[model samples]
Target chain A: MSEKLYSISVEVNGVARSAHVPARLSLVDWLRDDLRLTGTHVGCEHGICGACSIMLDGEPVRSCLMYAVQADGHRVTTVEGLANPDGSMSVLQDSFCKCHAMQCGYCTPGMLIAAKGLLEANRHPSDTEIRAAIGGNLCRCTGYQQIVDAIHDAARRMASGAK
Target chain B: MKSAPFEYLRADSIASACEALRREGDSAKIIAGGQSLVPIMAMRLVRPSLLVDINEIAALKFIAVERDAVRIGACTRQALVERDDALASRVPLLRQALAWVGHVQTRNRGTLGGSIVHADPCAELPLAAQVLGAKMVLRSSSGARTLAAEEFFTGPMVTATDSSECLEEVHWPVWSEPRTGCAFTEIANRHGDFAMVSAACQLALDGEGRCVRAAFGLGGVGQTPLAFPRLAARLLGTKLDEAVVKSVAQDAAAQTEPGSDLFATADYRRHLAGVLAARVIRAAQEKAGGGK
Candidate 1:
């Protein structure tokens, strides 16, 4: 017989989404495959890469490490949710573009989520704090200097009342 | 890579979790934070027939500070433990070691009991737990029992906790001494990577800067984290001079049986064990001695 399925209802990007998933269905797969929110990339299906990071109840965590059933009653925010209400890029994303933070862009979504998570709690993070925040995320390109610069610039912009 | 399919059971109560574990026996696995478990599962290194999720069990998630000990429930997130100032005041080594844990994202979900039970020999929390001589409470449908950290950790990725048992909580002894100081440090390729060698030291000093009570340990150089109570006793009545600290750290490192891997040779890990153990011990001593 096939594996049993469990139903879960998660609030994704502020919208309540429900699905029937197998016990082994990872949260990242549910977001990308079933929900069609492909912004969250999958890299190194294990927890190391952090490419599948998402905010669970406002705290960033590795979605690949969690099964979809584990997120049944939780609120999840993917990279797609980081955009402005008018669908424009958020300041952090804008800063990333302004700094050319991404090369091939594979690691950008997770990077944005990690940086956003850091900024929400720490309004003005130091360079060391920014590096530590994105330490789990691995980008073979950009050497991480640009990503750190973008996050540093975003913090400055946000502090100066830039929407 | 993907995990092998399994039956998912979310236990609402600790007792129910124990019952489920007892029923499934060897074929079942308890998933708390899934930080360590999921990675292995995705690699297909572990494929349990039943996956018991204890994350939602409210009884398994708590941090209670008692008169001489701090009891942390099994599912308490590492981030919560890292951020809790009061708990840190009671059990200072916990936060010191947690700083070197995976990262914000993983720490946000990883649980203390999970890390200790998963029991990677080089894990930061397990090394801290070893140095602090923490007590782990294991529960099954039959009953609950406690084991000391040294006894609980048998080998790499192994614990005294059996398949039928659920780790309910961990009790960390809180040193009430006024001059108690603790420190934890590790050498890893990356900030979040597993350490090549890790050291933890917690020492209490009297007003005269003489060691009264001390505990120190090293990880990544042994089957399980190794604590040196007898060697630490040699520091009693001393001011923790460089000679004694170096001697104790070297002696402790000599007893370890580190394995050679791609990252570090056994000899190099042994060498680092001595260096790091001495570093942390001095740091802890300086803190207790008020930097004198």
Candidate 2:
């Protein structure tokens, strides 16, 4: 027997969006395939990989591990929403570019979102805190040292009153 | 990794959820954080025809400190529980256990009630709940009843909760006895992997610093989290000296029936449990005395 699909209305990336998704439709699928928010990549599909990481109500979560219907009425932020309203890159985004934090860039979106969450939580996270914050996220291409350096640079720029 | 399709039901009330579960019968499953269930569903391990999303129930997200107990609603997120000021002040062991549960990302979405209902034998919350003698509140269309930690878990990934019932809340007793302390220790391959062997120990000291009440719980050592009642009795009324603590830890480890897994053999786990028991007990004792 198949389950019924439900129409759920959720605010995605500051825009109120609605979708009719099957109960089995993962939140990552809804964002990447249905809403065309490909910035949120799906990796492993299981909770092991943080490639589908997104901010759910200002908290980082693996979108693949949640149903689209479950995110109804919740605020979701994807990598595309990292830019300002004027489409300018955030400090973290610019830092990634400046620090050459992208090798293959497969895990870049998830890394950016994860770092975005960390910066919002603690604008001045220590090296250890930075490591702990992004521990769930994995980058097979660029060694994590670059990601850590990018986040630290971003934090420094943000603290120095730089946009 | 598409999950098997199921009829999605957004329940606003506990009564409605129970009724939906009853109507759907064994073909229904309730989802809180969907951290564990969604993955299992994607794996097709469970293909319930009805998917009950209980996130809309606002009543199931509170943590209240009661007179004799702390009442935690089922939908309480692990991060919220870990960061809760009251829980940290009263039950620091809970925070310690929370750090061992999973990484921050997983903890952000994993719910306490969902973790307990999933009942993974190696799960940190259930093991901690068992050691703390927590009580689960199960509600259904018929009525509600409370079950202790040991009774709540029947076997691996199984609980006493019936098909028609949903876990409402868990109540953990608050210890007001002075000079008492608790500690939890777990060793895993990574930050979030299943623990090889974990121990939770509570020590209560008397006026002369003698052990008054001692409780020990061992995890990942059997089909269910176990308590070392006999070894606890041996520690009670003792001076908590190094020799006595070592003896009690060895006895506690001997009582375990650890299962052999790829990460550790049963004998190795038993040995680790003994070492951990001794370490955690000593730490709890030192903390009780406000020392190193």
Q: Which candidate has the top score in lDDT?
A: 1
Could you give candidate 2's per-residue lDDT for residues B1-292 as a string of tens digits?
A: 7887678888999999999998889999999988898888889999988888888899999999877789999999999999999877777678878878877788999998998899887788888888878899999999999999989988889999999999999998777778988888888888777688888887878878888887878888878887777788898878887788889888888888888877789999999989988988888887688333
B-chain TM-score, candidate 1: 0.99
Give lDDT tens digits, candidate 2, residues A1-163: 5446688899998999987878778899999888999999988998987899999999999999988888988999999999978999988999999998989888888889889888988989999989888888888888799899999999999999988
Candidate 1: which docking quality band? high
* Per-residue C-alpha lDDT of model 1 across residues B1-292, encoded as one tens digit per residue: 8999899999999888899988888999999999999999999999999999999999988999999999999899999999999998889899989889999999999999999999999999999889889999999999999999989999999998989999999999999899999899999998888888999999999988889999999988888988999999998888898899989989998999999988889999999999998999999987776445
User: TM-score (0 to 1) for chain A, all models?
Assistant: 0.98, 0.96
Q: Candidate 1 — which residues are off by over 4 angstroms?
A: none
Once superposed on the true structure, which residue ranges of model 2 sit more than 4 Å away at CA?
A1-3, B290-292
Return the clash pairs for model 2, or none.
A3-B6, A3-B7
**What TM-score quantifies how close candidate 1 is to the native fold?**
0.98
In candidate 2, how many Å is residue B114 off? Answer: 1.1
Instruction: List the lowest-lDDT window of 10 residues for candidate 1 chain A.
Output: A1-10
Worst 10 residues of 2 chain A by lDDT: A1-10
